[model samples]
Target: MKQHITRFRLRSVSAVAALLFAAHTAWAVDPFTVRDIRVEGLQRVEPGTIFASLPFRIGDTYNDEKGSGAIRSLFALGLFKDVRLEVSGDVLTVIVEERPTVADVDFAGTKEFDKDTLKKAMRDVGLTEGRPFDKALADRAEQELKRQYINRSLYGAEVVTTVTPIERNRVNLTFTVSEGEPAKIKDIRIVGNSAFSESTLKGLFDLDTGGWLSWYTKSDRYSRAKLNADLETLRSYYLARGYLEFRVDSTQVAISPNKQDITITVNVTEGQRYVVSGVKLEGNYLGRDDEFKSLVKIRPGEPYNADQVAETTKAFTDYFSNFGFAFARVEAVPEVDRANNRVAFVLQADPARRAYVRRIMVSGNNRTRDEVIRREFRQFESSWYDGDKIKLSRDRVDRLGYFSEVNIDTQDVPGSPDQVDLVINVTEKPTGSLQVGAGFSSAEKIALTFGIKQENVFGSGNYLGLDINTSKYNRAIVLSTTNPYFTQDGISRTIDVYHRSTRPYQDQGGDYRLLTSGASMRFGVPFSETDTVFFGAGGERTEIKPGTNIPGAYLKYAEQVGYVTYSLPLTIGWSRDSRDSALVPNRGRYQRFNSELGVAGDARYVRGNYQFQQYVPLNKKFTLSFNTELGAGKGLGGRPFPIFKNFYSGGLGSVRGFDQGTLGPRDVTGSSIGGTKKFTLNTELTAPFPGAGNDRTLRLFAFVDVGNVFGENQPIRAGEMRVSTGVGLSWISPVGPLRLAFAQPVRKFAGDRIQKLQFQIGTSF
Candidate 1:
């Protein structure tokens, strides 16, 4: 016969007295052997759990001491609400009240966090579906929800949890959260500063009182983490300016009684400025002291700058690592003379030992193949560790554009002092995109573009793309593919097939179209890590459609060429790019030389273009960029250069502040017949958008542009070039890269067409 009895804690006065009486009376009766152990009141826990928790077995002796220990052990499991042991005729009966099971967790009024996110967070802290539920755990969950909102600057947020008992030993939990408005920073004040003005010091901080752009930057909101970072910036500003003894004494953050406003006050000590006296080397340098000394970035007579000191130390450490000293240590010991206001530094170095790489491991590349990444590594396994090559390998993998993050870590092999393992980790990003977009312009009204590209198809380092543009005036279709490892020797092969139709005067007059179709195959041979040479051949047929608005130059050409032309184009090009970032590059040099020769078919001509671009970072927030392009073409074998192959320069991609493709010689009826020679120069000063909190996605650029196209018979003249100065904005938004510019032409001829505003979206600059 089975009997069920739920356990109840000995909390009542009578129950406690009875437990004491039983304990006192237990000495009167001799300890008896346990015949059998029976467990009751268990719903979810197995009987074996109780058997394993009990101190006495069925064949062992049972006493009050054993019963107490058994109860304590069962209660410690946290799976039971109450546990008790009772003895009746030597058969010990164990009773347990199982904790209520969580049937379903629900949330109400929670807008900031996803429902599943909250459920998962609770699961991590021992509260989940079908898990034991307790009042203490529920209280902790409520506090955790509030803490999340608090971190987001919602000081007045509240979370209330309700537990409702249900049938089948289950309880439903509901967490209702009221996320209030974020607290705003009302005021920021700096005190105890004599070297710099309050405004100047406050300008160095990211957190501040609300500004016109605060809604976007969120700097007006109070965030402890952001505040901490700003404090560090303030300290660095002083340290870099020769205040070697600067100290941030205290910071006070106050919140209003309503919890809607915050105020911050910073106290700092700006000690006397100092100058560097000298620098010396101290510790063992492996006999390369002179080589290491040349790497110092500090000047002896310069003001004592902490940044320079830190840079000098880091350079020393990196130089040591380049010689297989992976565990090198370098420290800058400063000797300060307060009376003379000068500081001297003694660089101490310790090259612990030399090591070689034992194994090369790659991880975190879920989509990209291993070979695609390994081929970029110049450092080989089982070779002496070369820090410079390892860094280069890491950068090469990062430049592939398939990974968002790439990291190299050296791990010491166990029991091997002179051996280490190199681990390369990469986090993959989405490599395929299907983009469809439409933009509006006063001239075209609406232009639609579509593109589908896969940079790493099926985890192979290959590229396939299709492009289609459907603008009433310009329409085209292109299919292209590239195999980055064409011959498994780092050479790349690309094939392209394209059909295009262009109307030169559709915006002004009738639709006179030029239709062209062609295909090309190119191979890129990498001469160096940063340089490539491309050579290819292509065939094309061009047809000129009859129309009233056709330019005089085109009409004359069509009559001689019979309204059709054919050409076999040979192309050779070389390019070198060392840009730190393809988007928003701060420092780099990019140059390209391209030549096209029409060798076979109805046209014989040669055209070449050379372009160079350089970017220099003037400071942390500003970059100076310069670009120049030159193009020239001439007929060969007594045949004129193809009219459709002429070069054009103006507008957004060239000299702005003028009508697109209108800077060259004009044909009869005032149509821009593109010329055979093109030249352009562009310069820009770019910086992050103001009040954007270091977000590189948005930037502002001021530029100067100069260029013009020259006809086939016209001599290149610098006096005829157009010049413009303008300001532009570049934003890398979720949709695409968007550019907008406002320009004014400084010099223009009487007949020059002027366009002051230009914009384009859905393209990378």
Candidate 2:
């Protein structure tokens, strides 16, 4: 009975174990179906975001592989820090900890860069205010800030970032930067240089020791770009002086242990000096071999001059381009014989194709219209390219004074071997000004002057000017207009109207005033690129007012003629101006001759004036200029000297150290005298400041001036003229040219001299 009961209990236990094991296997193997998905610990992310991120959806089979993929997808959004997946029966749950959103960004102790610039820099690295904050991005922002500071030579700068959590699942970031002392160049050294002195080479660098202007130009700051430029300058200097194989082998910049001092070392290799032994030309002559030969400026047996070689090559290329060979290539192949230290050049020319201008485009002229620039071009579209005409067109644009920069570019047309396009770019600048000022002198206590002028009206290259001056000694009004291009052939037209009054200079003597009004029209015909001939005609009326203190000679003339007048006059003039600047010439010549012949007038008269000026640049820093003027006037038809035609000299524009219009013939009361003939000479030497950079705008000048006035009856004598010597400063400021001078009368007649110091504003010497 015991055995049978034990066997039944064992069978019951086995059945219960089998049922439990079967139930466990069924629960594990049954396919899990998700009825809904729940997300928790999400503040910034929406519930739909997690649903969209899940790999498994409702009614889909849920497996371990799909659940792991869902967690990874949620984390990949970068908006969540922690993601988890849970399963309960047929329901799936997703939990996510969203990253904190950036609330605000703050910077502390930032003077090197503006707030906006820093914000931009931060945003570029994904650390903006509204984006989700991350540790890696914040660290990257800190590193970028430090790098920027280092670029500015602040090698000792420090940057720290702080992240603070705020309400509404947001955080604030603050970047604290400490900009330390900037590294300075303690010394610079050159190695393997024997052709030139180290000091001479150092002088060519724009990066130098600190100077007064270093704060503005920041030349004391070190930069890789500046170093490269300095290296190029060094190479150019050597190559220009016959050093054919000059090169900078390597450059090294060393910083001190304290990060406060830097030393630059440049290793250069200066090879043998080369002398030209011979030159040969091989190219199509275009039936002008003699002309091409004449264009070769590089001479054999002279030191190899890179400039002359380049000029010869360019001349050959230009000659070809003028004949529609736009793709011509002229290569100057130098054959160097190292043993003999001699070089030979072969000018090889290739005329690839004869190309025509397919299109003419104008750009970069924001203010000037396209038509204005196109009208000035000598080269036209749909025509054979002419390099000479294109160069001339560029020069004309440069001379307009309305553009600061001008350039021309050419591009080949696609699929068209014989076609090219030309583009012209220009940068426009202000060309109009209004001036109102007053001048003080012993003769004229205060002379008020007003003037308005526009060199380029509406970017049309036309000129208009109005001038008015009122003073006790002189008064005048003038209106003038000039059209630089009145015709397609480069002829200009000018119209002028003027009313002028002049008072005779007298010291407590007789006073005299004359009034004259006239209008003139002139036509300027181009004789050459740099020369012009002008013809004009005008009519004028003159009335003379006699004063009580007239000279005895003048009184006799005044009794004979109460007033003198002229009805009409004709004028002819020729001018050539090739100077770089009209006010202060640097390198060129200016010549002008004008003559007025009486046609039909009450007081028949003839007057002529001739002026010549030349400027020669002695070197990069020194220039010498010479000026000469001659004037003559004669009264015809038995008329006494027309008092209005007399000449007076003094002051800044003439012989300095004397009052204006006070250096000529004087009345009985020791007033200034007027003459019918005038002669003057002026010379100046200009030099740049020592130790300054290659800025030619500021300079010092030494000058000598000699001038005098003589009557028609009197002969011109060199002894009668007054002379002055002086020194002056010239600056090309943004406002205009400013000049200040101090002069001493070297040849002063008794009781005729005034102050020794003379100065003028808005004038150039």
Candidate 3:
């Protein structure tokens, strides 16, 4: 029994012994004055640490109480595993066996997490290098590591800790892990649901049984967080469909004994559906009762919908906020009649108090400058709070494309009733990227392209980029920069310098090229909140090189305008974009118009182009989009239209199923020289990719393309357009937007080059 008790007491045996000694000394050994002190058995710890914690020092009176207190205090320090106190002729001696220091911490068989990450986690739990090592602490760390693996669905993962004592009382620790297969969700059952079928209800959840794309979507993995999110989605689905008293009563998750499969069962109660009988408002409206009533979205004749009620209350609160009431409260109180299965909504509003902003605070911007974000805000400090301006300010910051998240919060001032502070919280993201591409070929063998761009250079809210391409067919180097805030009023300025040497057309084998160099500056003026107008001018020289396989049209142009031609091109453009996303837009409209003129050059021409795009969402998974473009050019001062300035259309971007830039009139050598007038139309219907739930980055699109480039004198006629219809895939990849099309021409003339399949990156129609 004594041995059993000793084992059970474990590390506390020393404390128990010290207490017994103190009792004996009080009874038999009398207290003595300590004249000197000495410490022993310490390896790495300082002596002062022990001296400072002692209850009685040198020349001080010692007693049983002080002896007991000293033992307790030293034990609490955690640096020593054993401590003892002795008194010999008024000279006290302290002995301590110090705990071994942790010289190193390591892990084995970890694939899912980085070693440094695990070390940091161990450090948080008081187990790390340079710290005292204890068996209890190592056991706690082992448990924590197992918990981390369990969170990743590895239920069978095992962690074993190994400790090796080295020289100088230092120990090394290693956590060897055996990570097993992940637990997949084998079954998901929704019970107590009758209004909707089991399949329909399950369809709303992101987690499910195994599917073809399970590996990519990971929807079959059992995650507590994902389960909770799915449960919320299920609740919302029923709430939106007029289930007034619906709720989830219980959820149960079970894992198989092998730890490779999981089963989930959810019990829910779907209450009676109700229809709205009437809607009323019952609160202060600040003398704008009519306007406040207009914000109501509830329809008396329709079914009761929680979404409409939430929208109405949110609108009411925003309306009150617009009048400087920062602490406004609005709610929709539902009156349900069980007998008739009907409900009525009463909107209650309270405009608490009017307040103005005392100061504006910004945070979470580790790299971006404060001025970069402040200039985007329209709501100023020491002014009345306006919801419209605040919302606009958030949108503007988001549109900067430099931040991943932008948020604003209103905080009340302390001891002040009519003042508040606006806090702007921003999360920064990588605002720069470098892309390099290389390939091997014969003519353009060893092709390489290196491009780099920084949208927020040094946190100054400026854009800088460099593009370099080296290939036999096309080679160019360009530098560009933009200052978003050139002046105090938000006008932007951009500069561009480029030198190019390339064969812009595919004519079998061509050592021929066009050498061009130029520089330009542009200024953009914001015409409105959604529109911007730009105007710029530049001077460039175009030199045609004579080589084997060169086109006859180029030779003719060179003879007429000499081998070298210089032009000062004047440009103006305007754009209006309201799209929700630039890469994948589901609902919005975009319009742009640009025109250029070669005013003082041997090659005198005026060119204009216009584009219009509209996207309409037909349903949750389908979108209908249309694109239209038109171009026209004319010669000035009786000079013929410059052959170098032409529009080419075909292949992936326009009129797929035809060769790229091969739809226009061909020269005598059977080579495409392009055309001066062009028109194209694209109609597409996009849908969700199969087995990939809720991933908008990948999608399937069926498009019909119709367009053709016309000669300088040819009229732009719809009947002459080449048309094709096909299906394709679009993915927003890390490199860029990738598009692959498989098309077949529906309307085509003989001698038209046919290319049934095409692939491209960063081309949009």
Candidate 4:
């Protein structure tokens, strides 16, 4: 009986201990239905937002797991700095400390960037007005400002952030930035290089030590990006010279204690010179090995050239892409023979799959119409992918003068390996301009010009312009418009109405005038992508006003054909322009041929002019251009060409050495009497402004000009042509395009007039 009692007691104790454990577990994770939910400490955020973020709702089971998840969801909103949950009975309460809102953002002592720009930058990083503000974000903003200064080589720049608490639980951030003087490269040294001289290697770098033009070029500025670019150039130089194992081991940029000067050191290892032992193909060549082999630029028994290898591979890839292989891959693998100091290149090509363009998409053209860009594309939707056609289409769009940037991206369909989409993205630029210009010349004194021009009028891909000029010598009023897609067959229509009165600027033919008023309509038919043919007709009424100092040519015309004359002129022209840039051309050719016939008028004559220009890039910094123009006019039937139609040379647009319109034959009063035949040739070498880096808006050029005008009976003679040589500056300033030249006549006659300096502002030639 005693043993049974003790066993019963032990069993009772075990049962009590197990019950306690179960009760503790139940208290820890007991699920209860939420009877009420309430949020506290909400200023800007809505209560509904908090309720939406909660993982548990009223009447939902609430446990430790759900409570933790609810806290996490609330914190992830990034609107609260502190979040806490409390439970009383079946009610759950959430308490949050909302982040301080940014009331305002301002900058002080920031001359490099404007306040609006800096604010925009901050806004981009989620630190804008009315947004959540915190120390972490403010710290990031400070770092971003520092980074911008560093990019400008401002090593000593300092930024201080001041957070001022304002009303309504908001804070205003003030970034006080002090941009220090940019660190200039005082010295650049290359060590451990033996194959090339230090000076020779240094010439390959775009960055350099301080020079006379350093202030403008900023090449002396110490920038991490520029240093990396220079290092890559050095690598390319060595690699292209057959240094197969060349490498830039280390580069050290040290700044002075004052942070105003910097020194760069580059250490390199050029292992050995290599020769190309052989070249071979290792993959399928679309069953045209010979054709593919012909594209290889690498030659056996020649020094190994990395450029050649890259070119050969790129050529293979492009060739494959031309044949509908949109995802082609071509890689050149080199097998090095260390003992022989030679390498063999094996080109591997993979034509992954044939694909066609499923659709051509255009985007980012906010102002321009979709059809305007589509019309320029040579590659159509559903066509086989052709790399050449795609490139041409991109170029055509770039030449439209409507966009600042044009890019083409090919996207492959997820489920269709044989289908792709071409996305043409364009960044639109301002195509309209209102120009008001005033320029002074020695002869014309001061000339004022005003014009309003719109190349893409209202996104319709049309052109409209109105010009008014008030100059003593030349005055004009004109209106013009063009429809680029007149007939939808790529033919353009242009209409122009103009009235002008001309008098000699230098001779001041006091009150004497040749008035010309006319209207014309023209159509430009595209013969090819780069060629166009234009034909038009117009009627002109010319009047010779008699007065003191009248030009002898005009007097003679008035005596023969009366003071007033009318003519119906027919015009036809052809032009081909493939220049890389319309404003600052650096390559390609521009050729034009234009002719005018006075078929039914008081004056019967035919006039024709031909001009050609070619630009060749000599190097990264220099461009060589050549221009030639020829014009001739003759009487038709038995009548002489109108004196008003005479060609005038010797000006900024012609021969720059002599006075404006003062070249060729002269009358008794020593006034220029322009002739019917004209020819001119201009050659120029253009380069970026000293210290201007790669800015093409400002440039300097040295030119050689030769031209002369001849009478109807005079013969064309090289000896009779005037020659000039000078240096000039071309600047595309905010006002307009300006050109200034100081020319010296190299060849001239005793009767020739000289004007050494000439300039034109707000003009296009």
Tell me the whole-model lDDT of each prediction, alpha carbons only.
0.85, 0.80, 0.87, 0.86
Error of 4 at 16 (Å): 35
Residues 1-765, model 3: lDDT tens digits: 877555333322244566775566324336678899998798888999999999877878887778779888998999988897755556777888999999999999998789998998899899998999999999999989988888888899999899999999999999999998889999999999999999998988888896798777777888899899999899988988889999999999999999999999999999999999999988789999999989899989788888888889888888887889988888788988999999998888889889888999999999999999999998899999988889989999999998999999888888999999999999999999998988543224466889999999999999999999897667899999999999989999999999999774564776887888999888899988889999999998889988988889889988888778988999999999998888789999999999989998887999999999999999667999999999889888887777778888888777888887788878887878889998989999998777776667778999999999999879888788999999998888776787878899999998888888777666665
Model 3 vs. true fold: TM? 0.91
Off by over 4 Å in 4: 1-32, 63-68, 82-95, 299-302, 337-342, 441-444, 687-698, 762-765
Better of 2 and 4 by TM-score: 4
Counted clashes in each candidate structure: 0, 5, 0, 2
Question: How much is 29 displaced in model 4, in angstroms?
Answer: 10
Worst 10 residues of 4 by lDDT: 10-19
The 10 consecutive residues of candidate 3 with the worst lDDT sum are 6-15
Q: Is candidate 1 or candidate 3 better by TM-score?
A: 3
Q: What is the TM-score of each candidate against the true structure?
A: 0.89, 0.74, 0.91, 0.90
Q: On a 0 to 100 scale, what is the lDDT of residue 21 in model 2?
A: 42
- Model 3 Cα shift for residue 386 (angstroms): 1.7
Q: Which parts of model 2 are misplaced by more than 4 Å?
A: 1-188, 210-229, 252-264, 283-290, 435-450, 468-477, 487-489, 499-518, 539-567, 598-603, 657-661
> Whose lDDT is greatest here?
3
Per-residue lDDT tens digits for candidate 2, residues 487-515, read: 97778899999999876655564466778
The C-alpha stretches of model 3 lying farther than 4 A from their native spots are 1-78, 83-97, 439-447
